[model samples]
Target: MSRIQLALNVDDLDSAVQFYSTLFQADPAKRKPGYANFAITDPPLKLVLIENPGHGGTLNHLGVEVESSPQVHAEIARLSQAGLFTEEQIATTCCFATQDKVWVTAPDAEPWEVYTVLSDSETFGTAPILATGEAVPDDEAIAVCCGAAENATAPGAPCCG
Candidate 1:
């Protein structure tokens, strides 16, 4: 069973835990100071709630765990067919280690990736530089926002604890 994890920043840990527990309709399987986790047995999603004192609320990222590299390729094609505009998919490393997979984006501007690495490492392969004339989709604009106007970029792209 693969798991999808989401990290959310909230103002209060207790309140957030309560709300999520009621929302998920089950008690968390794990709870620690300033952090809580609920594992959904239905769809099997693991949600992590972390208390950030002045959080200002923002979604850190979204992750999807797939079984293999072929699954990653399928996800990219699926994203493109859905018209979400993928920012060029490339074979690159991520997280400090185990950086093998593909990333896609949702129409609502959310990034989703299908990956299959388990260990945490300190180096991911560098992303290939996009050539000129590649249009960056709005969903993936956040990645190339810092003065990368020279290359035409695609959309879709993420990280974690």
Candidate 2:
């Protein structure tokens, strides 16, 4: 199975690392001059952070996983139905690999990319890093919208998964 990947821009690498460590509850799998990454196995997610020279703050991009090309198309349709903005797929090469995917612009204007690999030989290079989604201010709302509500303890809403 493929993993869900996420990347974000930070103002301070050191502070971001400490904060993320508390958030992810684990040390970073890879740390560099202005970046840090974590591979979360349990949920099958990959996360990375990069220092923004001019910009400062959190809330990057969003990414979702799909199995095949058909799945990607179906998800695009589904997200469109939900009123999400999606960009057309443009054939290109990145990270030395060919990708078939679309970019999504959420209601909040955050960029989200969805892609499928035609080949895995492009695993080298800078690695396909992405931007952050779900802005910082929306963190609490995201928790609630994503079902993190503490008061949502009824049969319908489960407490903190």
Candidate 3:
């Protein structure tokens, strides 16, 4: 199964969780220090809340959560074939989980990813590969989940993932 994932930045985690839970009539599937997610059944939505102070009520990133890594690989190929730049992150950790994913940016610069979670993690994020898709040293990676790749047209770029 697959579900669209929405990651939102909030100033307060507790407040956002409370409101979303009340609105959806469901609790978070996972809760961490500053992160929470809901696996909504009716609408099949993966709503994620990120405690990013001063960026309340704004989108953090967007994604589609698939069932496995093969699905992620398929998206990478499909997006690339369609002439959209693609950045593939395999076995990367983000949002307190290990994931296999591919990223792309919309015409308006909105970041989107097709991903599958492999397991939970204790870390919040890892250094995404550089704009060249090279696995540079951690010190050299750009620190944005949205992508440093937007500046370039060619495939392969950086992201906060």
What TM-score against the true fold does each predicted structure earn? Answer: 0.47, 0.50, 0.82
> Compared with the true structure, what per-residue lDDT tens digits does model 1 show for residues 1-161?
67896756667879988887888898976666555667687768867665656651656446666666677677778877977555543344443335455555555755555566545444322343447756545434434321122221223222221
**Model 1 deviation from the true structure expressed as Cα RMSD, one decimal place:** 8.3
- For model 3, the local distance difference test gives 0.75
Give model 2's TM-score versus the native structure: 0.50
Residue range with the least summed lDDT across 10 consecutive positions in model 2:
152-161
Per-residue C-alpha lDDT of model 2 across residues 39-59, encoded as one tens digit per residue: 677767767665654444554
Q: Measured by C-alpha RMSD in angstroms, how accurate is candidate 2?
A: 13.1
**TM-score for model 3?**
0.82
Candidate 3 C-alpha lDDT tens digits along 86-147: 87778877677888888888888788889999998887667665579877555333243334
Off by over 4 Å in 2: 1-4, 12-37, 80-84, 95-97, 119-161
Which candidate order results from sorting by lDDT in descending order?
3, 1, 2
Q: Runs in model 1 with CA error above 4 Å?
A: 9-43, 46-57, 88-91, 124-161
Q: What is the lDDT of residue 16 in candidate 3?
A: 96
Instruction: List RMSD in Å for every model shown.
Output: 8.3, 13.1, 5.2
